[model samples]
Target: MEQLLYITIGGSTHTATMVSNAATEALLTRLKSSPVTVTLNSSGGFEIWGALGFSLPATDEPVNAQPGDIVLYNGSNICMFYGTNSWSYTRLGKIDGLSESELRTFLKAGESNVKVTLSLSNTAGLQSVDGSVAKSNGSAYTLSGTSACAGQKGVCIKNKKKIIR
Candidate 1:
């Protein structure tokens, strides 16, 4: 089955169809445990790049990255393009259903320290009460979509029901 990567920035989520590669496989495996949030900065007016804080297996090859293209650089950094660049990178995935202008806005072009979260959607179509993709372990999520423990106060979703704790 094809896997989807959900990239959330500024509360707006975009989906990407993951490419079949070792780098992507490693990323999915890491995301299975929890979502990874990276602080990215705009570079060269073309892409938002950052260190993933973890390294992935890379099979670097010449790539002409275009808008919406996500790639891994130097085995540890992640780059999301909003303009264009030619570089050797490990292909990760490409965002879908967004135009160039939309990509710029969604990626916060020209911004610094933009927070981007990467998560995976399960094949079962299970979602948190807030309609965000559920964690791989099916844990309850808070209204903002982060994993919530029983001790957390405020509204949370578990098994598709809203529960106030």
Candidate 2:
């Protein structure tokens, strides 16, 4: 595919954790109840690609279900071979970072169906009982929508529990 289908975080820093958690919840809500999965990959690092995928709801239902898109985080195996560790190697580049213009575009496009998922190497982004970005809105800030999440409409799957904030 031309895009990456996964979201991966490399560090346990505060900013990284917040973004990682928010991104994952935002993406999962966009998935529209699709089956979720995770895997481990050992990349060599010749390439790194990021993409946002979308799928519309099969039926028109008001349940906060809309056509949304997902922002995928990716890295190449080639980078893993470099001196850098997995965290630095997998962290997205300028093109995939929050500052990229595509961030908004991806969210807007995926507002209907794409559920965002994030894979973190550390616990930086874990949320409390209340839905809030643990860290300040640094490079990114997400707009709220129709999902169970109040600030945002997507559901968050953390610690293996499905919670919609």
Candidate 3:
């Protein structure tokens, strides 16, 4: 199933989809309640690999990564890309709704050592409170849609255990 991950940098938050795999699931499990923080570094001659740092305490050798992509480097580090890289990396997720330029700008904001966050978004269809995806009615759920969360099949805000499918 597709999973939604929120990437917050400073004040701006970007939406991303976690790739289906052992590493992704493990990462999510670690981040189920709280997010992990790490320093993001700006790299490459043209800053194509912006915010290209952080470690997740998990690892898997996957192969490679590209622009707008998030990956696990050597098993425990989270690498967000503004440019492409050839290496053994497990993909974490891909940020949505941002152009190449927009992504580059956001990632390269500080040029070095920027902080980023990864959190779970209920739209990931993690299953209802009873471990089922059945529709939970009432104000517990709302359809507050946004460009970042486009093509959503359902939406549930923070502090509420509700899902619309």
Candidate 4:
């Protein structure tokens, strides 16, 4: 629920300036400050996005991700970087409770519902998982993924409480 902005990237373009730019853009947006030299702590790897692969916009008129290159969100961890778009929300921490099976089912269901909510609703802005989850305390649990949500590592949660009821 606490929405924090962090940079995320893959191994494919570590050396590429574009990768740096993407990170820069994310940081700038998240940090909302003038650009400056920044040091990043990262675990290296390569991943691609989109059906074709690449997530970078084409330099030419064709604005789409190229094949083999994965699309990246500005603030997510890698892997399921973008549940739908190049951006997603993420949170991380030591899970305090909930059995493994319960956690699994919660995440699976939450991910599915989140995707549907995202697609159907105009949720273009970043939302506080911690804030929302906090409100639903005891109703939800976290599912952690090594991958990025826009490029940051953290926990994903499955809320057990039924809001619909």
Candidate No. with top TM-score? 1
Better of 3 and 4 by TM-score: 3
Per-residue lDDT of candidate 4, residues 1-165 (tens digit): 222222212110011122334443443353344212222221122222112122322222222322122223323322221122222312111112334443233223223212211111112222444544434344332221121234222333334322221
Q: Clashes in model 1: which pairs?
A: none
**lDDT tens digits, residue span 129-149, model 2:** 233432232222221211122
**TM-score list, all predictions:** 0.75, 0.21, 0.64, 0.18
Query: lDDT at 56 for candidate 1?
Result: 98
Top lDDT model: 1
The C-alpha stretches of model 3 lying farther than 4 A from their native spots are: 45-64, 122-165
Worst 10 residues of 4 by lDDT: 8-17
lDDT of 1 by residue, 12-35 (tens): 666898999999999999999988
What TM-score number comes out for model 1?
0.75
Specify the poorest-scoring 10-residue window by lDDT in model 3. Answer: 139-148
Deviating ranges (above 4 Å) for candidate 2: 1-30, 47-95, 98-126, 129-165
What TM-score, to 2 decimals, does candidate 2 have?
A: 0.21
Give residue 32's error in model 3 in angstroms.
Answer: 1.1
Can you write out model 3's per-residue Cα lDDT over 1-165, one digit (the tens) per residue? 788887766545667888888778877887786766567777662232323343344546755566688877666556777776677767778888787778887676337777776677523323234312223332233222212233345554423444444
